[model samples]
Target: MSVDTFAPCIFRMRQTYVTDVVRMHLEIFIQPK
Candidate 1:
């Protein structure tokens, strides 16, 4: 795979993973109130 294509795919995956984690934390800690 080319670096240009691979880099964006990896970046997008990381971004999605981080977003999921942040959403989970918010639901667990902020939803209780």
Candidate 2:
């Protein structure tokens, strides 16, 4: 795999993980109120 394709693939996975964590945290914060 070339850097052109590989770098984006890695970035997408990280982005997905960060998005999921942010969403989960939002839900948890809402539950407290």
Candidate 3:
């Protein structure tokens, strides 16, 4: 694959992974102890 196309693919994957992590952290913090 070309670098131009691959760069965006990697960025999107990283963005999604970060979003999932943030969501998990939010859920954990919002829960009562």
- For model 1, which pairs clash? none
Candidate 3 local Cα displacement, residue 13, angstroms: 0.4
CA-lDDT, candidates in order: 0.98, 0.98, 0.98
1-31: candidate 1 lDDT, tens digit per residue: 9999999999999999999999999999998
TM values, all candidates: 0.84, 0.78, 0.87
lDDT of 3 by residue, 1-33 (tens): 999999999999999999999999999999977
Candidate 2 lDDT, 1-33, residue by residue in tens: 999999999999999999999999999999989
TM-score leader:
3
> What's the lDDT for residue 1 in model 1?
100
In model 1, which runs have C-alpha deviations exceeding 4 angstroms? none
Error of 1 at 21 (Å): 0.2
